[model samples]
Target chain A: MALLEVTNLSITFGGLRAVDNFNLTMEKGELYGLIGPNGAGKTTVFNLLTGVYKADEGLIKLDGLDITGHRTAEIDRDGIARTFQNIRLFKDLPVIDNVKVGLHNQFNYSTAESMLHCGRYHKVEKEMDEEAMKLLGVFDLDKERDYLSANLPYGKQRKLEIARAMATKPKLLLLDEPAAGMNPNETAELMETIQLIRDKFDMTILLIEHDMKLVSGICEKLTVLNFGRILAHGDTKDVLANPEVIKAYIGE
Target chain B: MRKTQKKTLITYAIVIIAYIILEIFMKAGMMSSHLKGLLVPMVYYAIAAVALNLCVGILGELSLGHAGFMCVGAFSSAIVSQLLSGAIPDALRFILALIIGVVISALFGMLIGIPVLRLNGDYLAIVTLAFGEIIKNILNSIYLGVDSAGVHLSLKSQMALGLADDGKVLINGAMGITGTPQDSNFTIAIVVLLISLFIVQNMIDSRDGRAIMSIRDNRIASESVGINITKYKMTGFVVSAAIAGAAGVLFSHNIATMQATSQYFGYNVSIMILVYVVLGGIGNIRGSVIAACILYLLPELLRGLNKYRMLIYSIVLIVMMIINWSPALRDKRDKLRKKLMKGAGHGAA
Candidate 1:
């Protein structure tokens, strides 16, 4: 059975159908890519899936359990995590704290225990610190763990956000425009990091990218969306070769 | 130690050392009686300011109904203490009063937080402001009395309770609660302040604190990370309210008669607490305590200045704001701190 299945997911705002009858099915550990021109509603689909926006009509299921319209935090607890296009880190906090926030649910200490620094609080906090440090190490951010996230350079900030998401231990990870603002070298590094995270963590990934090179290098399957609907989807090369995909990208 | 943990330790040490020094000076007759009288109030207000900071600074929510929660604590605990007077030891009675005040105020916090926390920014502030006014007005007109039969309550006055001649009027409408045991002292106030600091500081360093701060930093990001926003928001708000309530109990016991007037539990008082938090530096627990103590005592200390007292106070406030928030000064302070830390080999090595 697929790890995630979305059927007839549709939403409209005012008169515009932001997403229309979007359907997706993903087996465990698949690396998928979502591509679209600007305003093609790719992010809207992600928003709907993550429960930032409710779909007007549809069903979203993970591990065969219906999860449509669940709260964003609930969806995350159910093993789904995502990175934002704008890179939202707790700017004033240290990089490790940002990752520790992603590990929020894994700690079993009660508020009273934490406030008194007793029992589970000490044990769980030590464990979380170790875990957060490990995740930061994976992204080459362990050295910068004590620095405030806002002080980091752009590429590291982006990588830190993904590392933070990984701390949630999600079964499926979503990346919205992960390569939107990167130099060629940084993009190449991100591509390797993304591949490494997927393999080492053994988690499925669905990414939205404008960088075709990054998409082609890492994505196993591709889905092209245009005006809130899927235009073509299949093997990466075939979808990229479709005449419809070309016109959508070039604005015919 | 981590940088933040070390900072927290230094803050606590500074507060405790300063308090001890002041106490020593007072014992040596180096301080005036007016200054001595201000000590207990200074500690209580400092505690309240810390509580307010948890909401305004840490949780990143502007709450103006803090005075309302304080009032709830002040009245309920005052009544309990009055009822238990002569039957229990003063120390035990005072402790129970503080606990009762905390419980009552925390309940009010949760009750108010449920609907108000749903609104964000200005709307939340407005609702809390309205709640503060509502609580103040309700306390003004209400009359409460205890008799052999049981408790009696009325809105008009003592006569409305229609009690027996032996009955005691606990709350006399607009006159507020009277004859409550004055068990508050400098030592008790200081102990309360320390407890408040312990709770607020430990909370800020804890996992729950991280969740609260993350929500404040970015709601969408925090939610996406699987944090229950309502639960964490309530945690901060209720804990803050409980602390404020404890402070209120201390306050009521220090004064001869406790009144729930606008001057006491009004919008301005809420704003004053916010001012303390803001002037001290938001999310800085140590700053809140210092700001509260200095600001609360400044007027009394400057009483000899007569007409210029408020003027000097206002100028101090403005200067504090500039010092705390001015970008240039902040940058300089950060640089100085980094330099000192590096000089001490505190940086990553």
Candidate 2:
């Protein structure tokens, strides 16, 4: 069974069809890329799959469980996690707390236990802190763990967002424009981080990017979206050479 | 101790010591009668402000109906104490009243929160403001009575209750509940305030508190990380309402008669509580308590200033706003904090 399956996903906002008849199937551990021009419904597809928006019509199955129209948090708990196009770290929170939030579901202690600092609360918190520290270390954020996330440099903020999302232990991770505002050097580093995360965690990744160089270097398979529909999709090199994909990127 | 733990310990010690010193002065007749009378009320308001801070500051949801929850607690506990008077010792009766108030208020919080929390920002503020007004109006016309036959409630007036001579009237329309046992004092208020502080502070440091704060900081990110938005929001709201209810119990029992007036439990009161939270520093539990105490006592302290009392109070508020929110001040404060942490690190080494 595919790690993720979406069939005929359609959504319209007002008069605009933000996404229409979108379909995707990903094998476990596959690294896929989704690319489209401005306002071509790339992020909309991510939103639909993550349950931030209910598709007007379609089916989404993850691990063979039909998960279309579930709550956003429920979709996440079902093993899908996503980062935003714009960095959305918990800005005022310490970097460690930002990652610990992703571990919220793993704690088994009751609210009462936590309030009184009894039993599982202490044990679970210690474990969570250790795990969070390890995650930060993987992202090269160990030294800045005590600083507020907003105080981090722009590149580090983007990295921290990914680190936080990964802390949820997702089976399928989605990145939306993770390299949007980075310099060329930062983008190269982020590309490396993305590949490393996939290899280290053994997780499937679906990325949306406008940076052709980063996508070309890392994405094995590519899906091109235009006007809320798939223009072409297949192996990255062949799909990028398609005439329709060329026109969609350049002009009419 | 960890830095945060040490700060928390010092805050508690300072509060306790101040309370002790104030009590000593009051007992020695060194404090004025008016100042002494303000103590219990100040503590009650401080507790309420702390409760509201959990909702407004930490949860990042503006709730203007806190006064309505406070009213639910106040009236419910007052009625219970009246009904159970003479049957139970005052101490046990007061404790039971407080528990009952907390439970009922929490239920109301859940009831109102489920639908109301669906809205955010200004819409939420408007809805809660309306809820507070509705609660105040309802309390004005409510008539409650207890007798050997059981309890009776009427919305029209006390005449509608039609209680027998042996029966007792608990709430008499706008006249409100009367003859409540004045069991609350400054010491009890202080203890309750401390408990409020403890619960709020502990909750902020807990796993659940992290989830709550995350929701406030970034709702979409929080959801993406699998934090159930509704469940956590309700948890914070209900706990906030319960604490407000406890404060209400303290308030209702501190006086012989309690009226359901806008001045006490209405839109204005809710806004006033929000002001305390904002002026204190959002999400700072200790700041909320100190702000509540100082702001509550300020008016009484300036009462001798006559007509200039309100004018001076407004100037103080404006000055506090500048100090608390100015960007320049914030930068300086942050720099100072960094220096302090560095100094502490050197000392430890």
Candidate 3:
């Protein structure tokens, strides 16, 4: 059985069919990729999956449980996490604190316990601080953990977004155009980082990327979307070499 | 151990010293009783402003109907205290009164939060404003008096039931809620303010608080992280309402009297609460309280200009806002932070 099963999910934005009959299913530990031209509704599918908008029609299942219309955070607690297409770190807060925000559900202490700094409070707080720092170190951001998130350079900000998502301890992670503005070397580094994160965490991943080279290299399976429809889906090599996908992209 | 530590200690010391001086002035004949009466309102208003800050500033919800919850607390506790004053032990009655007040306010807080919490930004504001008006209208219709064989149907009407005379309005219509035990004052006000501060501060710093902030900062990003944005936002709204309700208890008793709900519940009070948060810098709790006191107290000192006091106050406020919120001043402030920080380490290492 797949880790996530999405079928017939659709959304319309005022006569624009942003997502129509979108479907995806991925096995545990699989690294999958989504590719499309601009305005192909790649991000819209992601938005639907994350529950940012209610789907006009669809059935979504995670581990055999119906999760359609569930709120995003509830979906996250059900073991899916995603980095945004645009980096959305809590700008004014320190880096480690950003990761700590993801650890919201894990703490057992009450508000009273935290304020009083009582026995359980100190223990839980120390563990969270340590955990947040560990995630930061994984992204080579331990030294920069005290700086405000917005002060960090762009590449570091992207890394912090991934690190913050990892703090949620998800079983499946989604990356929305993780390589959008990166130069060649930074793109290569991010590809390597994503692989390391998946292996270390033993998590499944579904990512949307515009860079065919990076997506083809890392993903085992690939799905090509165009105009709210799946152009192709198969092993990455098979889908990448498809005549339809190339025609849709090259417009020849 | 560090400069921030030393500075914080000194700031606290100065505030305590100032408080001591104010107490002495009160003891001396220099300050009139009327002026001294302002103390409770000052403290209570500050509490309400800060509580509003938690909703509007930290949670980023525009809640206009705080006075509705405040009314529930004020009237509920007033009735309880008045009813039990003669029958219960003096010390117990006071404690019971406060507890009942807080509980009533919290219940209303939860109740109102359920509906209004779903509305966003301006919609939420409009709904809450309507809710406040509804509460005021309801309070006007409550007939607390009954006439017959010395039995009253309800607490508000029991006074009428107890009255053995003709033509006396017991808890009269729109005359105002009278006979509230005037037990709340400066000492209790201060204690409640500190408690409110401590609560709001910890909440914003906690994981749930961060969740609320995350939604405010980025709704889509927050949802993708698997946060129930609605739950978190509603939690913030309800907790903030509870604080407002508690402040209402403080406001109700300190006045020791009220004529109409309109006297306290109005559009200006909401704006005043918002003003405190904005002037102090939106997310800074301590700064907000300081701003509340400055805005509230500063006008009173200019007594000779009483006729145009509000006008002058408005002018000063407008000028201050242009200076403080002016992007030019903010840019300079950022530069100043970078300069000062270059001289020292960021935190306790």
Query: What overall lDDT goes with each candidate model?
Result: 0.91, 0.90, 0.77
- The residue-by-residue lDDT of candidate 1 on B153-197, one tens digit each, is 998767889898779998898998878888998878888888888
Worst lDDT 10-window in candidate 3 chain B: B146-155
DockQ measured for candidate 3? 0.57
Please list the residue runs of candidate 2 whose C-alpha ends up more than 4 Å from where it truly belongs after superposition: B156-160, B334-349
Worst 10 residues of 2 chain A by lDDT: A113-122
Give the candidates in order of DockQ, highest first: 1, 2, 3
lDDT, candidate 1, A87-153, per-residue tens: 9999888899999999998877899986777778778888999999989889999999989999999
State which candidate has the highest DockQ.
1
Q: Could you tell me the lDDT of residue A143 within candidate 3?
A: 99
Clashing pairs in 2: none
For each of the candidates, the C-alpha root-mean-square deviation to the true structure, in angstroms, is 2.0, 2.0, 3.9
Error of 2 at A164 (Å): 1.2
lDDT of 2 by residue, A1-252 (tens): 899999999999999999989999999999999998889999999999999888999999999999998999999999999999988989889999999999888767898875667778778888998999999999999999889999999999999999999988899999999999999999999998998998899989999999999999999999999999999999999999999999989977
Per-candidate clash tally = 0, 0, 6
Q: If scored against the real structure, what TM-score would every candidate get?
A: 0.97, 0.96, 0.88
Off by over 4 Å in 3: A7-21, A54-59, A114-119, B1-17, B28-30, B89-91, B145-170, B330-349
Query: Each prediction's interface RMSD?
Result: 0.7, 0.8, 2.0
